[model samples]
Target: MKRICFLYCMIFVFLLMPNIVGATQSRDDGLSQFMFGISYNELLDTGDIRSHKAEFLAGEEIQGVFEEYDTLLYDKKNGYMELHLDASPCDCPGKITAAAYAKRNGGYLFLRNKETTCIYRHVNGIVASEPITSYMPVGFGLQMFLPEHFSLPKNDEAAFFLTAEIPRQGTTTTLQLKQIPFGLYVPSTTLLIDDAPLALADKAKEVEQINDPQLSLENGSFYKTYHNIHESALIFFDPEQFNDEAYPTELPKKELQDMLLSGNLSAIGEKDRHILEKLGAYASSYPPITLEHMSERFRFFYMVYQVEQNLVWDTCTMEWDSVAGRFRITKKWLSRKKPASFLEFLRDADFWVAAC
Candidate 1:
């Protein structure tokens, strides 16, 4: 009878021990409890997977721009949260490399890292880690610059597997987000076209009356030529600062600028032409006079469509006339196709021509 009484007391003590120690075991696998904050378009997620999976435009927090030198850039927002994982004190501060991958085929995308203040560990049914009290906020933030040219089509959804790997600890945790759509922006408007497509005749008529080359260039500017020339020159001078891969042919600075600015494909060789084509496919810094007032519409151009990689002949060119101290469209090309405004000729060439 005394032995039976002692066994009952021990069972009662075991149940009360959990309450005495400030720990709770909601689940056997602690890693499975992670939650992510996914921001789509302008909508913010409250660190809930169900909230993230809801229908919404993704990637408003990330923006892509074609820089002056034609190198693509993606500026991403920091402060994405990974919440509810166990963290414990350890001898070494473990580092985590988090990356986004294509969920369908498991293709690797981009990864970034942050050091963990404490190691996360789970043994049996209990999480051997620091308890996140009600006073403390759960989870940590992650931020990384994805590949410069990485793009996903507008409205086309794909699954993104976000994984955090702690190499030192030999542990990896993954959470999958489905139906993630990416936003795209192109440097040159002509990239919207295929096969040296000609601009529509009717849209060409809109700017036929504007004859001043300076005003004409601004009215229907091709990609930002002046900035492109300036940036290319800078890249050639300071390769460390800017990507030198932009200019593959390796010409002298003045020559490279002149070759790009000239718009005379006959003057430059095949490789130089390839460089020109690549630079021309991105959006220009200056929007056409038509789109200058329509800021929202201009933004739409960047958020839709993939860029084509060919140069159409009707594309405009601008050269600084030192004597006049202003930019002028060269006579050789425009004169050959007289009366066709450079802007109008390139106008319908845009893929968004119908929508615009």
Candidate 2:
């Protein structure tokens, strides 16, 4: 009888352990290295060549000007990956590297890598964000992103540890983000699985909802009881801090800002031009514009937003620009799903075009 009672208690204790364990997971300080990684199954699982996938957005387009540079390629053998996005008019250099390690489960692998992340400073202090290209490293200095050296595991099924040292700003070791209520932001994870072919996992559920609209650490965070994300409440950058207008004196006089909002692409600094061309392949879906024709309706462009599966999602609300001098268009990301004014469109883009 005692054995039976003890067995019942043991089973009941086991059932409650998951919730107890999950509650104790360590949270993060407001400032920690931000990273994303994809596992190479060929190196870890079966000996098969699989094509890993990733997406990027180059945020600059000048009239008739195209810059070229190397785009990040996902290597399946050693699992090295890189992503670069620069909108800086200054000649700045930045680089990030990535690699993969074996997960204990054996069926899956955990990615370990770090890259540059952003935060906003409004009024008194710094507000954490998922790093936007609103500010670029000015002048010339090496932006060293490699934390530490790592070696690939020779045995596909073996577990190993490698040393890495990623740097972060500020005095505090804790990772914090603005706009998000405390305790929601947790450590992030990303994985690319191998099925019949390689496939990307659903991030929200798989990675603890770091990308969830409600969990956003943006300046203007929004919450929703329904399934829909509140587009109006989101804010990408503080307008006062990150100016949206083009300063004539700051730009070169080689070409008219017209025909293109940024003038000739060649007019931009050499480093910027090179980065533009590197990310040029992604320009098709959201191409830069030259100038506004009378026949054309919208001023700037935006990548259409969708809830999932790349389906078109948006509603349109007209907004008029009164200052209207020379109408020039650049490849801007405009979401069509929720009809909103120019102000609201920007707010929505702030979250959509974000990094971990």
How many pairs of residues in model 1 come into backbone collision? Answer: 7
Assess the local accuracy of residue 73 in candidate 1 as a C-alpha lDDT between 0 and 100.
Answer: 14
Q: Can you write out model 2's per-residue Cα lDDT over 1-356, one digit (the tens) per residue? A: 99999999999999999997656421111111222222222212212111211211121211111123323333333333343424312232233433332223221122222222331110111112212121112220111111123222121110111112212211111111112111222232111011111001213342233343333333322111110221211211123322324222233322322213323344555443432222222224332222221001111222111111122211112111223211121222323245344445444332222222
Q: Across residues 1-356, which tens digit of lDDT does each residue of candidate 1 receive?
A: 99999999999999999896535322111212221122232222222322433321242333222112111111122212222222323332333233221112322222233333321111011111222121112221010112235443332211111222212121222211111111112122212211111222223332233232322233334223323322333333344532455566655545654433333334566665555444433345543222121222222322321121111122223332333322233321111232132223223222211111
TM per candidate comes to 0.17, 0.18
lDDT of each: 0.28, 0.24
Candidate 2, residue 251: the lDDT equals 38
Candidate 1 has its poorest 10 consecutive residues by lDDT at: 119-128
